[model samples]
Target: MFKSIRWRVTTLYLILIIAALLMFSLTLKGFLEDYFITQLEDNILKETRLVRSLLKDEIVSNKRVKKIDRLVDEYSNEAEARITIIGSEGKVLGDSEQDPLKMENHLQRHEVQQSIKTGVGKSTRYSETLKINMKYLALPVKHSGNIVGVVRLALPLTQVKEALADIFSRVINAGLIAIIISLILGLSLTKRITKPIERMTEVAGEMAQGHLDQRLMVTSDDELGRLSYVFNNMADKLKNKINEISDEKNKIEAVLSSMGDGVIAVDNIGKIILFNPSAENFFEVKEEEIIGKYSLEVTRSHKLDQVVMESLEKGEEVSEEIEILYPEERIIRVKATSIKDQDEQIQGVVVVLRDITELRHLEQVRTEFVGNVSHELRTPLTSIKGYVETLLANDNPDSAIYKRFLNVVKDEADRLEQLIIDLLDLSKIESGISGKGYEAINLNQVIEDVLTIVMPKVSDKELNLKIDVPAELAMISGDESQIKRLYINLIDNAVKYTPNCGEVKVKVYEDDEKIWTEISDTGIGIPSEDLPRIFERFYRVDKARSRNLGGTGLGLSIVKHIIEQHNGMIDVESEVEKGTKFIFYFPKVK
Candidate 1:
């Protein structure tokens, strides 16, 4: 309830009024007190001066002290106060209420001392003689222009204190009435002023809840009424603006949803403000989770965040490719563009992210394929040209030399032909141009056929080739020729890479829903870092050694493609010096 503006304004007025009253009361009270005391002091000083005139002649003579006493006693009643006469030697020569001889010397009195020094003195203090609060005034009796005696008068302050108390009582009563009246009128005026504001507040709250039609009523032509008029106008404009903004928002949302590339936008301080549905997969989190998070927290890639930060700080566009390892390993190409206002101030950064993992892998494979093909074909071509040119330059040549050169040229031609065949076969398998070949093929039969073809090479290396074939394994859906090529590549790779007398093992088995194959070789083995790209086209662990072994370098890549076509999965494990293993599984045919 205290949070309301009405109560707040009312409380402020109450506090101000109370403060003014307190200050005014204190000031008036102090003025009255000083006025009362000053008037009393002046009246007492005048009486003392009158009494001084009577005693001037009697002060210097001891014989006249009685006369002085008689005179003061008579005037004391008239003045309505006690009176005293003091000699020059500080002796109390006469007193109105007490015997002159019984009274103490007046020398130590503050008022008497002041009168002797300055001709007039006044004081108010508790008096022991009368046992009451008293005001004292003293005057020097000037005779022959010399001070001979001081006449002092004392007055009780009971009446003065009573008058001040009465004045204070009257002021307090009046102040109470004023406070009550002011509270009643002030509250009414405050409510009257705040009523229009309250109506406008209600309308604004309704507008917040999407009821923009709500408006204030203009009750008068005063400031609050005019404010109401402006408020209604603002409500109308706000309603129209909200409609337009909603339409724009819907369009933006539609565009972001349909986009294939992921989009993320952050404010100038790097808190995310916009995250599209497409971006959820890239970060492996829903848009709601990371909408207000930093880019590094969502992408977990510092390189990608650097692009965003650079775009924000420099107000320029930045692009980078970064790798993410969650949900799967992938390469993301991100482009961060600075969002700006009309004045060209950076407001935030918006980033478009494209998943380029496959694209990059494909490009790398294509580049390697082109280089490998050129090297393979160019070497043989250059040799053939060189040999033919030599035979032509020598008008006559030894037959054996010519035949040996011809044989070397033929061997080069064969190598070039083999590389071309492998390349074409891989392309056809990947492109699906020759149509998919689906048939029920036994895994055991395929392995046996591949072993027969690779057995000769296995024997040449003196490697021990072992096979564990289930006599009747499950058949899988695939092409017979493709499956044969897949096994031949796996087995040949195992045999070729194995050192002399190294062990090569092959196993074929089946579970309820699929058939599985395992091929492991105790060869030189592959490095752990090279296992991921081992199935990429033309990727070789040792290029010179692969060429020497007559490897076209497309065998493992082709094997992977054939397996994928058959709806299967393959995995590899390897150590640098121990061995390598290739395990694969194919879905069973219904």
Candidate 2:
């Protein structure tokens, strides 16, 4: 119960009120008691002075001192108090409440002793003569500047005690009434103050629980009411700000989810705070499983860990391309940046990873293409130069030798021209400049035309050629010239790779969704390991044989690009010396 604010406030209020009432009661009681004691002492002192005047001459002799008892009794009756008188010889000459003859020596009395020394004295004590608690006052009776005796007066404190008791009763009664009223008022005020505060506390609790819509009601213009107003306004602002933050957070989440590159965020302690879907896929782990785990434990890549640690240590961005072998082998380009606050204090690290395997492969292909082009161009030029130089050195005007050398130069020139044409065609196809639009072309007719053109080469080699294409095969959507070039390259390659008298066959067919073409040749087949890379530009399985047959080594590569442009797939099957078959599949036009 004490833990409750309302109870505590009420208790505090009660305590303060009780304390004030107690202090006021005590002070007033003390003041009244003092006032009564002072008035009583004053009345006794006046009586004492009156008695001294009455006995001024009588106290000059022992005969007059004998009447001291009578005078004291008279004054004691009038004052309603006990009275005493003492003579010069330290004897009790008279006492209103005791026999003077039987009384003890009076000079030893504290009041009388004090009076002898200072002319007037007062004391309060339990008096032996009066047999009661009394207030005593004494004065020196003087005669012509000579001290004759001491006159002492005392009052029993019975009336003073009764008066003080009366005052105490009234004070206690009034104090009880005041305390009751104070308690009532304190509880009422405490309730009024604490009710709104309690409500605010409840609302604050709700806000802490993420219910920002809770608000306090303002019912007055008092400080508490104004505080409620401010609290409600603050809640409104908080709700709006939280909503804005949530929306922004959702936007960021969406962006991260859809990103092609992997994104990871770690806290200052190097624990994973955010792992996006791309990052999950890149690391082959679920984000939910790895959150709050250390980055090193999650990634298991020392290079990535080092990058993030370095960025955090240096308070700057660090980036590198590192390969990952776990989950899968991949070449990834990672960029790590240190996250910092407005104070320029390092907070965490953010890493972005881009898979660059395909890019690296393309770079390698480009390098190989440059070298192959140099070698291919150099070969024909070297042959032509040697033959020309041979002719020049002979110098004897031998017509037959000159004709043979010129024929050699012309064939080399023609081969070089074909190589340049193939290169140009490949560049155009790869750059999307060629076959930009598709037209319906009959595959059967394209093949027939290509076979007719290459039939002479087939005849020269005495190779048996067969064609098996459906005349009613579905037309495919592609450039007519590109389709013709595609068929011509496949047939030419098959004829060139085949030895003399080897058999070459072409078959074309159509299904419900696709058109297919297969070119089979009994040729020196591609090795099994080279099938994957057989279509790469300037890659020759038998380089010397390809060169002797006037092959530019770009024919298969051109065929591949043309087929890809037409949204077709081409595959090759081969055995070392048995045979090779090239298959093409094209989407059938509806």
Give me the candidate number with maximum TM-score. Answer: 2
TM-score of each: 0.52, 0.68
lDDT of 1 by residue, 1-590 (tens): 77877777777877788889889878987898899888988888788888877667788564677888898899998999899998877888889989898888888799989988887877789988789999999988776787778889998999887998898788789878877887787779888987877777787888899888897878799889888888888888888998999999999999999999999999999999999988887767888877788988887777878899999999998988888786678898889999999999999999999999889988986787788788777877898889888988987899999999888888778878888888899889988855455788877777777888988998889998888988987678878898888888888888888899899999877889988889999988898889989998777999889877878778999999999988999999998777889999999888
* Tens-place lDDT digits, model 2, residues 233-270: 99999999999999999999999999999999998889
TM-score for candidate 2, please give it.
Answer: 0.68
Question: How close to the true structure is residue 327 of candidate 2, measured as C-alpha lDDT?
Answer: 79
| Candidate lDDT (C-alpha), each | 0.86, 0.87
The parts of candidate 1 lying over 4 Å away from their true place are: 1-207, 210-244, 258-272, 277-366, 386-403, 451-466, 497-504, 521-533, 541-545, 573-580
Candidate 2 lDDT at 474 equals 78
Clashing pairs in 1: none
